[model samples]
Target chain A: MLKIKNLFLKKDNFILGKISFEIEKNSYCVILGKTGSGKTMLLESIAGIQNPEGNLYFDGKDISNISPNKRDFGFVYQDFALFPNMSVEKNIKFSARYKKIEDEKNLFLDLIEFLQIKDILKRDIKYLSGGEKQRVAIARAIYSRPKLLLLDEPLSAVDPTFRNSIMKSLKEIVQRYNTTIIHVTHNFREASYLADKIAVMLDGQILQIGDAKDVLNSPSSIEVAKFLGFKNIFSTKILGFEQKNKFFSIDPNKIDFLKEKCLDDYCFECKIEKIMGITDHYKIFATVKDTQSFFAKIPKQIFMELKLNEGDKSYIFINKKDVVFI
Target chain B: MKDKSFLIVFLFLGSIIVLFLMVPIMNLFYSVGVNNIFETLQDKETYESIFLTLKSSFFAVLFVCFTGIPLAYLIARYNFWGKSILESLLDIPVMVPHTAAGIALLISFNHGYIGDFLSFIGLEFIDTTIGIISAMMFLSAPFLINGAKEGFKKVDIKYEHVAQTLGASKLSVFLSISLPNAKNDILNGALMMWSRGLGEFGAVVIIAYHPMVAPVLIYDKFNNFGLKFSAPVAASMILVSICLFLSIRYINNKV
Candidate 1:
């Protein structure tokens, strides 16, 4: 369990926080933000690598002023900072040399085997590929069986094809070790897939923090909604809702072409302006009476069956349950 | 056509300097008779001077390693007041004329308060092995310190951060991570310092002229005798120096 309260960090002109958040024990917490949003800075502050001006509690122990080495946390850098002077095996065993790790040999073996880095155990770090380096770095970090693990863009350097498998392995590592994880990434897909809790960070503050599903389904503000890729956000007055000074957003995938109105469906007429083909779906951009525009992500199969074309008149339907008021 | 002409001109200019460096050393070999070179090698005084040069330079490098490494690490890792000024100050010895550097060393360690203190403690630099080592250390220390500083600079701070998070103490991380990562540069610096110390003349000559290092002995030979007598010693020193330098470099590269 980790609690960061009013954590403040300043490096030159860049300041991060007044940040307050808590992660449940053994839960995966993802800090999601764009580049230069102080995501890494916050992670470093939590790791005690950067001196921060607030209280940090781990398992109810105030560890704000503890040295990084004494925090018993493992950090995986974005660049997979493996020791260049050591072989993969030696790197994995490095923490064992300094700490009194029980079952050190078994932990080392399990990590290398689980991370699939056993083959390169004798190879120098310089000869490894980026993906291989990442695996080794992970193996080295997990070998110590640390209580908490901080990952900075762990899969950014891996090939896209291997990312899913690596993510699965990371989750499995957390589960098996019972290690609380704080993963920092800009990719919403990664956060949606891996996080139990999500913290949306912008500039130097946490804009929203909650259960991943809650944050995903109902963003707290327009900024958070836009960041989560909500495509249909409009003032309630434009949509004719009774609510004033309120904005509502609907997930693109939830909006559909209407045939007949259902009891809970909100229906409106729009003309298709443009249709763009994505990987496995079509994104239909439509304008409501040539005023407010919105895009809907329609499944390729459904779009093919409907046989819709640009500039065609269509009815857009959204269920009341899908509308999120912000 | 113009590029080709410019290339030719550059090559011509480069070759002149290359030849300038090579010709004199080659002439030393050519002018010295083989028997004289063998005789110089066999001579007790000549070999002793060469041995003294090697020993003094080795000790100088040892001293630099102990004192300069921590300073280099500080300069590389931290930003504090007068950091740039401190870095510039380290290079002053290289810029100062060797004779002036010799005078400065003499005034500081042999004739000044430090000298008096050292003498009171039953240690004196004048005309002693310690004097030779002090002179060598004074002139060659900058090379090692600067080299090590640049080396430490090149090591990514992320590695150290990660090492610390892996439960390595500050000292452990430095010893296992920082120092080993900067090994090549430190080695190169030591070699440069040692090589520089081997050829030091002006400072060592002023400090200790009796227990002659190779350079001082060569100067003494050339001054007291003629070119004919000194050529063999110079040739012998050069051959040994080249052989030692090349062998160490080869070993360093292989490792």
Candidate 2:
């Protein structure tokens, strides 16, 4: 329902461009990137709130040059941007005052009730907590029932407990309303959980865009894989693959975790370099045979059982079938 | 206590200035009883001068609102090549000698294209109520503009962006979101402009001395009949100033 083609933007020394993506009707698209990756700039460009050299098509209309007010898009800022002068109800009602999509009140009631902001509807914005402010901001944005919803790091400032519930409610609300969404965040976990299609952006360009699992499991390049924090990314030739596709590969099945250094089967002695915590999983980086460094993603139980620490010696088992050509 | 010596030093330094300011106003109040101020208010000329002062200053604030808000919004939100220069220029009226401002205004607005063009339009400023208002607005506009700029600066621009994405036009976002959020500072600016305009003397006297405001009338009374004649008018002006000051303080606290 929404397509951005060859979007180019230059702000000072930072440039973002050729950002092309399409979101299906009612689909959730997440723009994932690191800090200063121009993620928010791309979102603002698509929202038509910033100047960009590109074209955007929504519902078969070229809306590249239209004002933001005519875009029929909802935006949730990272800061929530709740109107301090208005109560929660009035802030939500403020958006409604500008545009009326239909002669319907049930949707507004559902939003207010489902977002769990009805209790604080009469309270001033200053008195609300961070989570409460986010709720109100979303309610205000959705009350207008815009065709597209653009969220710029909506979960960044939210408490962890509220973040999960907010994501769940947002997904449910989007499905119920049949609204397309594009969310920009530097957090991969949020993207993995919330996006139907994940677009990985680095610097100013998009490196990969596909299903969340596809991007995570097999990134297009080692750079993309490294950025996505894939544990094992290296240039290893596959035994049976054609010469054209044998150069880039990943070991899909995790390497075996060894408590003591043992050279048995496809085993190599290595020194632990770093351990990155990924939610409940653990990613261990170790140098193999003092020549090459490789990382292994193991279950937290296996990692704890081995009790590995940085700079400690360890061994890992690898198999031929574990290699997957990207 | 650890703070005792610091507290004593602070009190000693602060009380001297406080007493220096309070002594004259208190002595003025002691000399002019409430009966004198009340009798002065009974005079038609005293009432008209005070009323004219308020009326002109109110009109001055209205003019400032018309011309100053957009400039303030620009200064607060955008940066341009000469933005800093423009901001400093706005403050020049506040720093310049009022008598010099009067002389400059009188010369530029005296039978020149601007003055004659305005005269042809039947809106003369020389020795007229229009001149008083013009002088008041020229002298007081910086306050309103500066205060409003500070107010607009405090409002996060993200709200306007979000409002626009939520389908609010630029004007709608400004009116509904920006204005109401900055209402306190805007009101403060208006009060400052009005109060400053009410007390304007040098420019107003040079431009429109015949139709006197409260300050000009007191000055005239002092020059013609010495201290005794002007004391009651001064007391009445102080009473009005105190009332306005108290009301502003009360509203500020509530806000």
Candidate 3:
């Protein structure tokens, strides 16, 4: 297990404000946040690149004081950070010159083959394309067979079409090597698809961390909810609730359209304000009594069957349990 | 029509400056007969003077590799009090008059406690090869230092961070990553510094006029035997400079 306790790093105007978290052995934990949210800073601190104040323990050993080389963690930077002065093969084998590898030969062959980088091993780093560079960087990082691998925005540079394959390769690497990965990115899809545990960060603080579905389905604060793109977040008073300083969030996909007003506790009549077709689904923007607006994601088949139009009145139903009060 | 006239004026002015630079050097080569050039090349004194200039300048550059590169890297990577003042001070060597610089170096190392300490260690810079090297290094060091500083600054720190995380020591990262990435600039700087050292006259004349470097030898020939005698040696030095510079640049580019 990798544990971080009250890690604080202050550099000029930016501060990684008192972060604390833990990842179980071999788990893929992702730190999800927007730009300048201290995600990369937090990862660098964990990698021992920055001298962050607090305790960092890996496998019950205090590693806070250790140098980055002695800490034995592998890092893959967002820009690939491949040694442009060396060929791809030399870059992958760079760590071998410094530290001993238990199964060097087999690991090298496996990484090259698995990452589909066998042919580009002799080429210079500047010659590779974006996707190729990404693979080469990953192969280089995991070639050392580190116990902990820290990746910063690995998929950000990759094209959308290649992300799934890269994501799959990352997952397979985790399973193969049992390397605990702490991947940092802002994309929710990446976090949702690849993360076993997700830590939602905002303003240099981790607002929520839990299982991928739990954090995505129910955010802990308004900041995290907005960052996670929760559509139906509103003041509870708009829904006739007397709770002060409280807001509720309902998932757009969970709310449904009804033909008539149902007897559900959270049922209300709303006018269809706008219907936006998004790939395979349509987004329904509805306003309850022309005051409380909510967005619902309807499947294409359901949207076609309902034949909903703009300014049309319809009853929308929300399950009481789906309303997350924050 | 305005753009056309502007282009014509620019091209005409550019050609005039190019010719201004090229004409004197070309005329010197043209005036020196092939027989005179061959005679100067075969002259033992001229050959030794040129050799001394090349050797001393090269040693100066080698010494800078040890002293200047680390200082440049430190200045590039870190920020501390008086850093701006230190950077400005580094450029002072270039801005000062070379003869005055030689006088300063002479005084600091010749008459003071520094001279006593050096003399106690059986070392002296007066009219010695050490004097020649000191003069060259004092005047030409800014080229290499500034080049290295800018080169190191251009290299992203991410490379070093990634290397450390990959289990390489800080020294290893600097040697394998930082140094190699910044090499072109550093090499360019060294070349410029060596070139500047090869042509140095004022400082070298002040410190070591007896053991004549090529520039001092040319000056001596001009003063004693007029332009007719010095022209062959000067032309020879220029030829050597051009050949060496072109060859090194070609090799650096190929690598």
Q: lDDT winner among the candidates?
A: 3
Writing each residue's lDDT as its tens digit, candidate 1 over B161-214 gives 999998899889989999999999999999999999999999888889979999
In model 3, the runs with Cα more than 4 Å from the true position are A238-242, A253-261, A269-286, A289-291, A297-315, B1-11
* Candidate 1 segments whose C-alpha is farther than 4 A from its true place: A242-245, A256-284, A288-291, A297-316, B1-16
When candidate 3 is compared with the true two-chain complex, its DockQ is 0.89
Better by TM-score, candidate 3 or 2: 3
Best-to-worst ranking by DockQ: 3, 1, 2
User: What are the candidates' individual DockQ scores?
Assistant: 0.82, 0.79, 0.89
- Model 2, A67-112: lDDT tens per residue? 9998888888898998887888888877677777564478668877
Clash count, one per candidate? 0, 0, 0
Task: State the TM-score of candidate 1 restricted to chain B.
Answer: 0.93
TM-score of chain B of 2: 0.95
Colliding pairs, model 2: none
Given candidate 2, what's the lDDT at residue A299? Answer: 82
Error of 1 at A47 (Å): 1.5
In candidate 1, which residue pairs clash?
none
